[model samples]
Each structure stands twice: as C-alpha cells, then as structure tokens.
Target: MTRATASGKQRRATLLGVLGVFTVHALLLVSRAAWAQEVGTVAEVEGTAEIGRGGRWSPASVGTAVQFKDALRTGHPGRVRVVFQDDTVLNIGDDSHLVLDEQVFDPAQGTYRSVIHMIKGRVRALVSEYYKQPHARYHIDTPTAVSGVRGTEFIVSYDAATEVTEVVGITGRVEVTSPLDPTHHGVFVTAQEITSVARGKFATPPTRLSDTIFRQYLKGLEFIGGGHAESLSAASPLLTGSAIPRSDRSAAFEPPAAVAGAAPGGRPNASHDASDLLHQPPGIVRALQNGNGDLGVRF
Candidate 1:
C-alpha cells in the first residue's frame, strides 16, 4: 500500500482501540450502579442525622437513604431509617454504627436474606413477609448478643457502660443468644417482652415497663420532630423531678417554638423539640440529668 494509505489505516485502528476502552469503562460503571441499587435503600430520616457535613434533620428536614445491592455509607451521631429492597424496615438510632452484612434475593430457591452488624449504639427493626420463607434469615449482632429475627418489631440497645444488651419485642418473636454459649442458650421471647442478656446468661422473663411508662414512650415519638429547643429548655426547669402528669402530657405535645417556628394559632412559640436537645435514649436521659454529657459513655 502507498505510504498515505498506510497512515490512514493506522489512524482508523487507533480510533477503534479508544472507542473499545471507553465502552468497557462505561459498562463497569453501570454494573456498579445496578449492584448498589440492589443492596438497600434509605426510606426516611425523622430528626437530625448528619448526612455529609452540617446537615441536620428537623421537622422541616426529611431525607432518604438508598442502597442498592451495596452498603449505605454514614457518619457518626445521626439517626436514619432504611428500607431494604426485600421490604424490610430498619430504624437506626443515634450514635449507632452499622453495615449491611449480606443481601440476596432469589425467588426460585425461595431464599431472601438480610444481615446487619451493629457496631455500636441502638437499633430498632421491623421485618416483613420475607421472614416467612424457611430459608430466610435476618440477624443483628452486638458485642454481647446475636438477635435472630423472623417477621417482628423489636428494639435492641447496647449500653457500653454496663456492658449489657437489651432486646424488646413489639410484635412477633426473636431468639437471643451469646455466640460463645451454644448449649446454655435460652428460650424465644414473644411480643411485649423485654429480654436482657449479659455475661452469657439470659435474664429470666424480661422486665416489663408499666403501661404508663410505655405510653410516655409512645408520646415521646413527637419529640422526634425537630424545632423545639428553647421551649423544652424553658420548661425543663419546672418539669424536672416532677412526673409529667398524664393530663399535662397532651399539652406537652406542642412543638417548641424555636424549632417549630410559629404556633398553629396566634400563640407564641414556647418550647423546643426534645430531638434538638437530647440525642441520647431514655437510659442516657437520666445520666444527662445527673450532669453527664458524654455520648460515648452513654452509648
């Protein structure tokens, strides 16, 4: 071939090689994205859970965490609610650390599995129909215990101070055990039962919180909404040490003015939401009253 023709042929070959490389790179990116979407997704955030930096969740702040067949990344000192593709709901409380252990969905084999490792703090989970599958397994692990869950609503709290693990079942059932003890394992706990496990021994019949206390907890849900720091601060003095009379509890439902911005009627903003002030749980609330402000110790 002539020299000019040879040069043109080399250029065409070089262009084809570049195009091939680009095609491969694009495919790799798409594969990664698809895998991530299959992992799990973040459904919502009630109050403040830091996302990137300086992002806080308030009454006005609602965010979603979405993970597809991959791990959902997070930072410290935040609360998040995640819904896996398998229709499982996982609520992560503040100061807690977790990672998606495994995610597999296969209809042919009738296998659907979800696993998470709780590195620290508290987590509440609600499992759905996926648990009915004989082959399905859902688990959450802490330093002291492993919770085997099958279609249930439950709360797990890890208190590093006492080195104690507490599990409360709202619905369905759960089996709690120490990985070290295989033979000495205990019985399954049903709804409305709170199980405490420590030193490889399970407590006999979990302590039951009174209906009044439990009702207060349900009312505390309103505190999850942001915008009430100042009002809560002002009322903190009078409400201190005094049992929040059941009658006044309904009035406490009002969101703090600083956090809520304005009242529904012509009333002025009076208080702040509990979320904005205290990031810890009920256990830590008492500690805070005792003049302790360390979250690490409380968690």
Candidate 2:
C-alpha cells in the first residue's frame, strides 16, 4: 500500500480506540448513579438538641438529616427523644451514638422500614401501630446482639465495657437474638419483660418483674407523702420554712441510686435496681451528674 494509505488506516484505528474508552467511562458513570439512587438515604431530622462530637456541642435543626459520623448527645441529663415520620419515637439516653444503617419509605404502600446500628449507648423506642402493616419492620443491631420489632415499644442498650446488650419491652413484644450464635438464638420477650444477650452466647431467659415489684414500680413516683414535703422544706436552705406541696416536694427529692441496670446479657446478679430507677413510671425524672455521683432528681 502507498505510505499515505498506510497512514490513513493507522489514524482510523486510533479514532476507534478513543471512542471505545469514552463509551466504557460513560457506562460506569451511569451505573454508579443508578446504584446510589436505589440505596437508602436519610429522609429528615425533625428535631435534635445538644448534639456533640469530641467535646464541643451544637444545636441541630429540622431538615438536617443525620450523617454517618454525626454523633448524638442527650439534651437533658437523661434521655433524648427522636420522632420519625411514622410516629415512631426513639428516646436516646445521654452519651449515646446511634448510627443509621438503612431507611426506606414507600408512599404508595404506606410502608416503612428502618435499620439502626448502635455502636455504644442506650435507646428507647416507642413503635406506633398507626401505620401497622406486616411489611413494617424495625430492627436494631448492636455489637453482639440484634433486636427485631414489628410494632412495639422497647429499650435497647449496648455496653462497650462488657460487650453485652440489654433489651426491655415497654408496650409490645420483641424478638431478640444473637446473630453471632444463630444455633442458640430466637427468644421472644413480652411487655414489661427484660432480656439480655452476652457477647458470644445466646440470649438469656426472659425476666418478668413480680407483681409487687411492678406495683411498687407503678407507685415509685408516689412513694413519698406530705410528711416528705416538710422534710424537703426543712432541708432546703435556699427556700423559706414554708411547706412545699407534696407534689413539689417529691419533685425536689433526689434518689441516691443508679436506675436501670447494666447490659441485659450481664450476670443475673447484675444490679437490676439501676434498670428500675431508669425506667420508673412517667413524671419522675432521674439525673446522673458527674462521673460516680448518685441519682439526683428535680422531681
């Protein structure tokens, strides 16, 4: 072939190679975009308060969807409340970090499912049945255990020190298991029952609070009477000698105890008193200040 003809053939080959490279790059970009759209994404952050990282704190606003690295800190000394679109509420306690793994909502079917992974901390969830459906699922995973709930209210805590998980049912039933030990997993706990799972072992038997204990639990906030009011009045150096109302007196009294026990899977002898104090009937607020200080309440 002539030199000019040979040069023309080489130029055509280079042009075809360039076109092939561009086509592959375009295909890869399209694939990535499609994959991201199908995956889970944060919907919204209705309300958040006193969120912190490292040691600094800042107030979070609505429409701010939580990212993977945004850690959550409680506003009050006790629990932080989070409300979802389905009216499901999660009350996270102080010094807790909840990582959102996946969340998807289907407007057509009115179905929503969420999965949250707790690295370390405590969370109390009140699952509403308003949007009750079979497909509505809520799952929480810890370092050692996992909990599944269809429509129930429960509390879950992960103890980094002991590598254990504790779960308490407040409204409905919950199924808890150890994903690490599938052979000995699958346990159901009803309302007012507590279940614990250790690091490598399966979940333990459910512990139902005795009626007396439950009754006392129900009256925990009402144990003290008017006499206690006088005691609080006399003890308060700041307040005048005037007697504080029984309701107000009880509100001022602080219990020197750690409510809410250790991780559920911990030894049976573990302090259940702590759990009691933490989950006391509503209207009673217990606060733990400093490192080892006892429970102090503002009633």
Best by TM-score: 1
Lowest summed lDDT across 10 adjacent residues in model 2 is found at 281-290
In order, how many clashes per candidate? Answer: 22, 9
Give candidate 1 misplaced runs (Cα > 4 Å). 1-37, 50-65, 68-78, 182-184, 199-204, 215-299
Looking at model 1, report the run of 10 residues with the lowest lDDT sum: 52-61
Local accuracy of candidate 1 as per-residue lDDT tens digits, 57-156: 2121222223322223233535565545455656667665565665555544566667676666677676766687787888887777778888876777
Superposed model 2: Cα runs more than 4 Å off: 1-63, 67-79, 109-111, 130-132, 182-184, 210-299
Error of 2 at 15 (Å): 9.4
lDDT of model 1 at residue 193?
A: 71
Q: What are the lDDT figures for the candidates, one per model?
A: 0.51, 0.51
